[model samples]
Target: MLSSLTPIVCGIASLGLDHVKLLGNTIEQIAWQKAGIFKHNVPAIT
Candidate 1:
């Protein structure tokens, strides 16, 4: 699971994988969920 990915770069690629699902199924929600890994003041790339 990418739950351990701490670099905090969010993408929409995996959102289509059957094992992963985004309720809103929108790029925005996927990015938002992926950004959950963000650390204080740390820069992230989407």
Candidate 2:
């Protein structure tokens, strides 16, 4: 079992560009995917 909405800190360092770049994914799209892990009341450092 996992705790949901526990207000944990999340940090995103980098999104692999060289690999996924060939897939035709835009930088904004990749940023969104990385930022999607953020939750309300949680501190996220990108």
List the lowest-lDDT window of 10 residues for candidate 2. Answer: 15-24
Please give, for residues 1-46, the per-residue lDDT of candidate 2 as tens digits. Answer: 3388575798888776654654337777777777778887778886
RMSD of 2: 3.9
lDDT per residue for candidate 1 within 1-46, as digits (tens), equals 3467554543334444343464446666655676576676556554
Q: For model 1, name the residue pairs that clash.
A: none
What is the TM-score of each predicted model, taking all chains together?
0.40, 0.60
Clash statistics: count for each candidate: 0, 0
* Every candidate's lDDT: 0.53, 0.71
State the TM-score for model 2. 0.60
